[model samples]
Target chain A: MLQALRDTLPANRWIRLVLLAIVLGVIFTPWLFDGTRALDTAARLSIFVVLAASYDLLLGFTGVVSFAHALFFGIGAYAVAIAFDHFAPGFGVLLVAIVAGLGVSLLVAFIMGLVSLRVKTIFYAMITLAVASAATVLVSQLYHLTGGEDGLTYRIPKVLTPAFKLLDDKVFGVRVNGKLMNFYLVVFSSIVLFLIMVRIVASPFGRVLKALRENDFRAQAIGYNTLAYRTTATLLSAAFATLAGVLMALWLRYTGPESVLSLDIMIDVLLMVVIGGMGTLYGAIIGATVLMLAQSYLQGLMGNAQDVIGGVPILSELMAPDRWLLWLGLLFIASVYFFPQGVVGRFSGPAPKEATT
Target chain B: MTTRVEPIQATGGEPVKQHRAWWHRPDAQAAVLVPALALLALPLTGDFSAWLTLTLAGLAMGMMLFIMTSGFTLVFGLMDVLNFGHGAFISLGAFFGFTVLAGLESWRLVDSLWLNLLAFGLAAVAAMIACGLLSWAFERVLVRRVYGNHLMQILITMGGLIVAEQLIYVFWGGEDWPMLKPAAFQGGLQWGDLVFEKYRLLAVVLGLVLFAALMAVFKWTRLGLLIRAGVENREMVESFGYNVRRLFVLVFMAGSALAAMGGVMWGLYDEVITAHLGQSIMITVFIVAIIGGLGSIEGCFIAALMVGLLSNYVGFLAPKLALVSTIGLLVVVLMWRPQGLVPATQGGQ
Candidate 1:
């Protein structure tokens, strides 16, 4: 069946293998390690895969540099938070939050595109950066609505809460509970979203986006309404990002400015795409998994480093958990310098569709 | 590429002077725009003294912004490389300045005015030299490799920034340090009913001096001429056997030094220094840089002042809406003049 599915798809066998690995990884996560911790990582990883792919839709395919992506993501998180705050926490509330988040994000993306598309690329980036910062400040200041710096904490749907334990029997040394069901909910939705992103990028519209990315001037000359296409891509990307944000808020049971709307999150998305492979949709999954995993484990490494650096005061100081960002930052620069096209590009080379005429 | 020099007339003929409208000259228009806006805002504030104080505060803030952004504008003009990590220099300068001031704590406590000035000058000088040397290394190691690629420049510079910010943590730890002003520079001066913060007055005076000095160098000095010529046509300057590359590196160094000075001044202004100080203030610097034609020094100055004034006024009027108003200003300005208040030689492209 796997071979037949691979044969039906345009992608090579490697994609099939990766997809199989992902499926196996998701199914066996509870058995592979301490159930909650590993499952938590898997869920977070899945959410990031969706988030990163949506970012690639803009940065990779559309060639527009936006610093306001967090705005949409924040809106999604806030939508869920606000909905929970106002309405009873039920499945219906979740659906409403998702729709509201997607609707608002799409509108914002459209308006941002319409205004910024008039200027040059760098100018557009500046406008977005300015807007993002202003939005961030606005979010923090609206204390009554956003809970100010404390952020918003709200209840998840009763069915998804661990207190409603699903199974009495222990499954693979882990208690089968509502939390496990919620984990599967996030994982499965993320998979569906990821597949949708892949399908979108594989479509003809995606090809036009790649063309625009390579050289928009030529794309415009060739009769493509480049601006319209780009705006559409931005809206699509924002919708997916909003979905990811909703899933995150649902999983974490809280949403805040730092988590949802910070510039760092936007940069993290950029880094994921760049490191994974800008034009490759699959790279988003790979980049997110690698970076997220590393981030999770780096804290452990930092704790142990003080012991290893024993006598050297400076080295011990540098090895502190707070200083881990220094290494990550240096790693980011080294990766960009060494792998300009990113890890995926190194293996796949340039996608044939983006070849210059 | 063609040099449009007029041919000498055999008969002592004079070239016709084209009479154009006054506003047609961008320089004339920009010269009037900033002060005109300030004058326009006067009626909004009913109290003259309060209005004057706010305007002066804004001007002082604008001068500090200009000090930081001028170097950024210059680097962009000479080499079309956008250094997103320019804030790293600012942060490093502040940190280094902090160290120098901390060391001179005894000097700061002295009753003598000269001793206080000495402490401040030493710290500023120390910070500048440290930042200049570090920036030289930064340019040689990272910036040189990604010259023409805007995407890579942004990526690498941002990476550089992240690394620098983290390094600050490694050195200084994750704590916000308070930087005290010299005793002489701490208090406000009272003249009858009006009072002006001594540091703000100092900042305004120093900023004007720096602007004047920059203008003088660009207008009269041989090095300045070379730099201007090189910015216009690098190939032409190269053909004339001038090492334009070296000149640009020197300019980058000088720009970094200037940023260091701005950092020291900014630290004094804010009274608190953090690892992320540079990154935080970079938003305003970028706005100023963008609104002041990206590569135009004079335009940068005007834009910085305007932003400073607008921010102060808005903050006073509605603190919650200050950033919103500033963003609104940026959008309006860009919609009206896409290139900025004074368009640079390269423009936004």
Candidate 2:
């Protein structure tokens, strides 16, 4: 099972150890942490790992800076939420929602890819930003169907809900209810998706993507269809992100623009992929975990420190919870200048230098 | 960066003025589209007065959008750098303007138009100065380091934007602050069947004046010629012993200051201010920049106007289409002109 879980291993032994610890940490979270938030964090970590790694396929490998990623995620979560809102909550509904999510994401990605062929690289970012901005506006304007700013809440299958009991007794001081099942469902799917992504990136198709990223002229000269490869990457990444969104929706039993569709989430995915290490799945994994941990604990830690500092107006204001973004931004800039290869890239030996593109 | 256009020599340098149709000029054709759009929307609106009002309002909106995007276009043109953090200046301008105006509330409360204008001008200048200095530091501390690395430039500038936004929150608090309109500028001027908001008229007059000033500077000033030459060939300009880097810093500061001024105008236009004001309008800025042709001030102006007009028209004609009208316009325009209405550098961007 452990062997099966290991897909594409990190090259560095230290990275491998970190990866194992992360996996172990997640697996034993139910035993290690006693609160609901801890379990929620684990679930979020699982989802973000898949999300960030998928983005790595596009930004890190193919060099496409898309701003429409959150739109794809929103599509996935909205599909499931809408499906449950309209139909009876059950396995059948879940299957339809999942299928709907993937289909729409693929279609949107395909259209975006085609449109992208017309413009240069930087223009692609502009188009995507415009599209994403328009989408949010449309969602809010068409509130009757999308539930607008209020968002939508719907029930999942009985088995996935907290009231459902899989076993009569408590397992290791934890309730063996549907919440555990939901967590395992997310974790299981996440691991499988992560492994699949790793496999995809390690494949020949990924090599072509890397080549294109390095030098599109050379890649084209080699007879590779650059457009087709780029579109395929977009599709694959969008599909995986959709799956992550589906899992998140099912776990929370709610979907909202802020939760799944905001530009902030897209920024997080970018930060994770870049700061973790571009062009490496391991980097993405590490980036997601680091971000998740920081987001979860940084503010609380700052608040504690602020209490210690007490009534220093400027210092306390600086340490306030809202100012976390300020510190995060500073850290992000420091990393970009200091670790151009990203954290994983710095720790893992330099990628076989392909003459720096 | 794309290839730069060649200079048209005036003294017997191959008679270049003869074989031309006005329609062939991309800029000429693009400029005509703005008024043409208003004409088209007139019928859809079905009321002459409503059409006139909406058209005027749309043009006013376009002017403001142009002011907002003008600085970004210059920065992109001269430096070939895409500053995603341009929004930080916009937000800063708004906050600074708000603070200044709050301090000058006494001057703005009176019914005297001169006093009100004076107060507004002071607030705008304050915003401009604050933003210009901030931009100088931003270029030095953050943007300069990421030169030539677009990815890092984008990431680093975005980080700068985030920090800037947080600082705004820390200083001004998280809630949206109400932007007060001066007592003298509150009412609309009425004419036979047509009406104009005083603020919108001010925006239009100010926008046109600024646009004309920008054009005149570029055409008449040695500094403008140098800047234009620098945009065309930075290395050549540098070779000619002019410090292009210093010129760039100067332009960056000025551009950011204009953007800050635009932010002040926008706050007055919206009658509100918030930290996320820049972020929310970023999409419009990007669309304007792209549609206008990167680095082309003329193109940015035309595109901004078109977007502003189309948004107002479509928003009134078809409520459902209002949200996505600009995107739809982008597709249609791109289909017509692949590199935008006017490509600043030339040869395939």
Candidate 3:
């Protein structure tokens, strides 16, 4: 039966369809196992998928390596909190949050772009990194606005109840509450954003951006305003990242320094893009899924083995939630050493060779 | 030992005819006066508290900046490959140092300052070797395939950074390690009304010594000459039959070692070592190096000092505006002098 199933799904399209089905099955399997945790993981991974795709717009398409992408993400989350605090609370709050987040991100992008546009490649990367770090410090110091380290939390408003009305109350056709509603909301947003990213990448603007990446000087010589293209790409990328952040804040119902803005998030996005393969929309999703799932599973396994080791309990520490960074670092090193093409790129034929000369 | 070679004249004979002392040259004056003034004034100007605090802080921070940028600048200066993983090396160094120190502590050697120092040294060495081997592996497996390609190098090195950070989390755990000051260097020094931490003062002294030693190596050593030549023209150096690839690795290792040394000092000064330290500070170091000019060691030093002073002073004034200062400086510098504060020598590029 397994051999026949495998034979039936031999084609790439068939395999993709089967994978999609399995993903959906897993997402909805909470009904069978009465475990909503897997659904929560998928929702979190979806946020990452969106974040990674946004990063790819700059890193892959426009050839701009931004170290401050997390700032935009943080800005998005903070925007949501600020918006919810000032305006009426509800699911409708997402609209104001997104606008505020994108607005801040755009302003940041413009300022950073103006500064960094003069320096290309490594220098630009440095400037962006400094800006990101500075933003973090600024946020932490501004006690009135950011609440310092404590961060701001919103009470999950009652308005979200109507959105979950479709659940309607059973086991096979069971009633799902706010958590499940939030999960579905995130999943739907991820799909919409993913589709929009696909549209953007397939557009003429993306081609021009890619051309700029291939050769900025050549593109300039050919009468393209490379700076404008790059700046636009950067702004757009930050906008998407901020949108993801807003979603994250709403889903988690909390916003903190650690929640959205961090070097960890930046590194994670970079890993997702590279591991998924650069210059591909689907690669971001694939990378995010692989990394998040691996981390989740590995942490579980490591957590369980803590008792087996006695002296120098590296395994127990490694299993700790905070230690996920160590695993991520190791994965990054291993990937660079062995699978440079990344998982998706490995099977998607030869990597698209960079033209830097 | 004091043999003097005739100064090479610029093409204009009239300018050469002027009886100006060599000390009048801008570069010569800068080289001699900058350090002299900094050294003399740092301990003299403010009250003991201010002077000692600023000087020690500057020194400690400057050394860390040096480590961060030296390798990055060298790699970019020589091969034009922007190794994003440079910061990862610093992060690794800090963790390595932490691990060694922790191990020593567990072994009931907590009171042994010398042992702690040895652990620090060993950690630095290990970090240098690890970075060198990693670079070699990177070059052999990935970089070699993308030779002369900046974008690919950026992406691949970035991937390397992510993997490294993840591995760090897996092995070391995510919490910040408590950085223990060696017992011998734990106390504060009282010089009149000013009080300075012994550890920070030590860092300052060590950094100056290292700076002098590195400068001496560059000016007086054969290896330095080869490095300079290699930076000038790798093809010509290869034509001269020197092993350029090996030289690249050696230069890279030296740079990584410098960064690792900085990382160790940073751990001591900051009193905390975390996995994020590398990525967090990596960008600022890049900014320093870039603002200092891509390949100039002297420029890196000057830029580092400026960055340290700016960051600290900014943090002091409008604490909320601390982050803005560096980014603001970078913007102004890039706008004013896109090549950096000091342009690379014509032949160097």
> Chain B TM-score of all predictions, in order?
0.92, 0.93, 0.83
Question: Which parts of model 1 are misplaced by more than 4 Å?
Answer: A1-23, A349-357, B1-24, B233-241, B346-349
Model 1: per-residue Cα lDDT over B1-349, one tens digit each = 6766655656767875656576766656776777887887788877888888999899999999999999998898788778878899999999999999999999987887899989988998999999999999999999998877676677788889888888888888889999999888888999999989989999999999999999889888999888777766778989999998799899999999989899999999999999889987888888998888787888889888989999888888778888888788777887777787778764212
Writing each residue's lDDT as its tens digit, candidate 2 over A138-169 gives: 88778888899878899988898889998999
Give the best candidate by TM-score.
Answer: 2
True contacts kept of 1: 0.67
1 or 3: which has the higher DockQ?
A: 1
Instruction: Write candidate 3's Cα lDDT for B248-305 as tens digits.
Output: 7787777876777777778877879987788778878878888777877777776777
Q: What is the DockQ of candidate 2?
A: 0.59
Expressed as tens digits, the lDDT of each residue in A1-357 for candidate 3 is 344333222234643564475457546645644455676677788888889989988887887778888999999989988777667787577676687678878998898888666566665676777777778777777878887787887755553433545455654665666566667777788767866776777677878887987788888899988888888888889888988898788777778887788776787788888777666656686788877877678666655565455345665665565555556665665654456545554565445454452
What level of docking quality does candidate 3 show?
Answer: acceptable
- Best lDDT goes to which candidate? 2
Across A57-119, the per-residue lDDT of candidate 1 in tens digits comes to 887787777788888888999999999988899988889888988998888788888887766
Q: Backbone clashes in each candidate structure, one number apiece?
A: 0, 0, 22
lDDT of each: 0.83, 0.85, 0.71
Question: What lDDT tens digits, residue by residue, belong to model 2 across residues B1-349?
Answer: 5875757778867666545477767788899998899889888999998887888888888998999898998888888788888999999999999999999999989889999999999999999999999999999999997777666677778888888998999888899999988888887999977888889999999999999999888888999888877777788999999998899999999989988999999999899999999987878998888888888878988999999999989988887787599988888888787777787764111
Report the Cα lDDT for candidate 1: 0.83
